[model samples]
Target: MSTIDRRTLLIATGALACVGSAHGHGEPKHPNTGAPVAKEQQPWGIAGEARRATRTVDLRMLDSMRFVPDRLAVKLGQTLRLRIRNTGAVLHELVIGTPAALDEHAALMLRFPDMQHDEPWMAHVPPGKTGEIVWTFNRAGEFAFACLIAGHYQAGMAGRISVRAA
Candidate 1:
């Protein structure tokens, strides 16, 4: 055979050897490429599994304002997963507190020049992004959640979370 043919044959043989070794290791097979799939790329194949394990909640922010759901009733002593999405132009936060606690917290937050709300339990979510929070409420009471970012709470970004005994 010519030198070019020999070089091509050697390259093909090397590729086939790599494929055979990968197969022996029980590697994932690429659909169209017919090659061993990388670990990171395997997520594409198990995307549904990953999505099934996560719980998501959509939230929106607009003009430095946050519009959240009015009421959220959860079971006491149960872990709750929350996903807050900011679909607004400005930054926002999700603050959790009791109604009385929020009242005091909101007052305290206003004292700081940069602080918008007073609640200690807060999640800051930037524009066009989502933030996740996992919380367990042991007490059954009327708890409030709001965005204490300056005027966000006043702009109606607050909601009530009623935890009832399960």
Candidate 2:
């Protein structure tokens, strides 16, 4: 008999899961209400309410593994409604986090390509579809957003966010 390690098991099962699972592409949700969580804090900021969004920033994800307007600037404490459109034929996602955090997550993604974890700071947009992430820049610092989808981030599907202190 042959023994399959965890990594091998996961990869084998992932293929089946990917085929059978329903992929949801959006912010973290409440288990009871299925509503987007609006108040988780991070080094960059916190989840924000859509109604409280003071401004809207439109972003486009391309098959070239890049984000349109790959850089952004915002004032500390301002709430932004990031409207992301996937103009690519493949799925792309916008995940906001510190560089280190993103790097760690991206590494994990490479190992478990079919991981379905969702957070308030990420949006997984499918081909020709749109998604949104409302966030508040409560902390003033540099951050980043990337698509941690298997080979996506490694291919440089990333962007920067600069939050200037008010």
Candidate 3:
């Protein structure tokens, strides 16, 4: 997965506070291959070893364009499985990352408009289908998980992840 460190996020946000065009932010590129990366993962968290889930939270994507419970609390280092279901009529995806990266990617989506991408931190689901994500909250900070499906995000398809110290 393409992960963005704190420094990159700060610089990007500091430049694009208004969520304007991502000029000078450089093309979103894959970290390893130097190839263009799409919707890169922010440095907030890593791909978890989800062999087993300590707990499970079922978050449903509704036609209202929102997650059932918009806020989740997890202790740092807690690995949990997210059972995601799409109850809407369109495609939806749950993407976990820093708010900065999410906003940047959302802006990018507005530009490309048809970019389809996925990563370990993401779960794509279609209407009436269910998807799953195993995530470990390794860091004790505020992160986010949102549906980056073009207008879905702007329509309020998002949630907050609060990882308190374990």
Candidate 4:
């Protein structure tokens, strides 16, 4: 298997292990009422309130390319739910950052022993699979979204996001 496939398998296995062993410490008891709490009240319960709010964006990845929207517009201070689907034969990443930051990260990403696992802003999605990124863009500026998979960016697999002032 390729390096990307190996890393992806490891990540998926780890996530599965986490989900399987996420039970809270014993049964939870309500603080004020001093009563045994429902399963939903457990700290690690899946039905509990979310830690953060979210938004959703659907994107697609083609072979050696990112089919991200040409210009994504959003307001500052909004949490983003970026869902990227990979329809490509090879691995891809969807990273969001300022132009300068992208340039810096791209430089660092190239130096990783395995280019597939180098970028901190990148998430691995196998071909025909989907992945998500929950992010908050706090600054108002023009940010670029790209797939920094080796020569993917140079192949024009990049787009821009405009953050309007609140």
TM-score of each: 0.59, 0.80, 0.74, 0.62
6-64 per-residue lDDT for model 3 (tens digits)? 46655544544553432221123123343332433346656655574698999999989
Ranked by TM-score from best down, the candidates are: 2, 3, 4, 1
lDDT of 2 at 89: 87
> Per-residue CA lDDT of candidate 2, range 1-166, in tens?
1132233334434553564333443333223345657475667798998899999999999999999989999999999999999999888899998787777677877887766655578888888888889999999988999999889999999999999977
Clashes of each: 5, 0, 2, 1
lDDT of 2: 0.80
- Residue pairs in collision within model 4: 55-81
lDDT of 1 by residue, 1-166 (tens): 3454345334533554455332211122122343331321110011112223334445554554545566777765555556777787666767675555455545545654343211113456667767655555566767778776555676777887787887
RMSD of each: 22.0, 8.3, 8.2, 13.2
- RMSD in angstroms, candidate 4? 13.2
Best-matching candidate per TM-score:
2
* Regions of candidate 2 where Cα sits further than 4 Å from its true position: 1-38
Best-fitting candidate, scored by lDDT: 2
- Residue 74, model 2: Cα distance from true site in angstroms: 0.7
Query: What are the clashing pairs of model 3?
Result: 29-37, 30-37
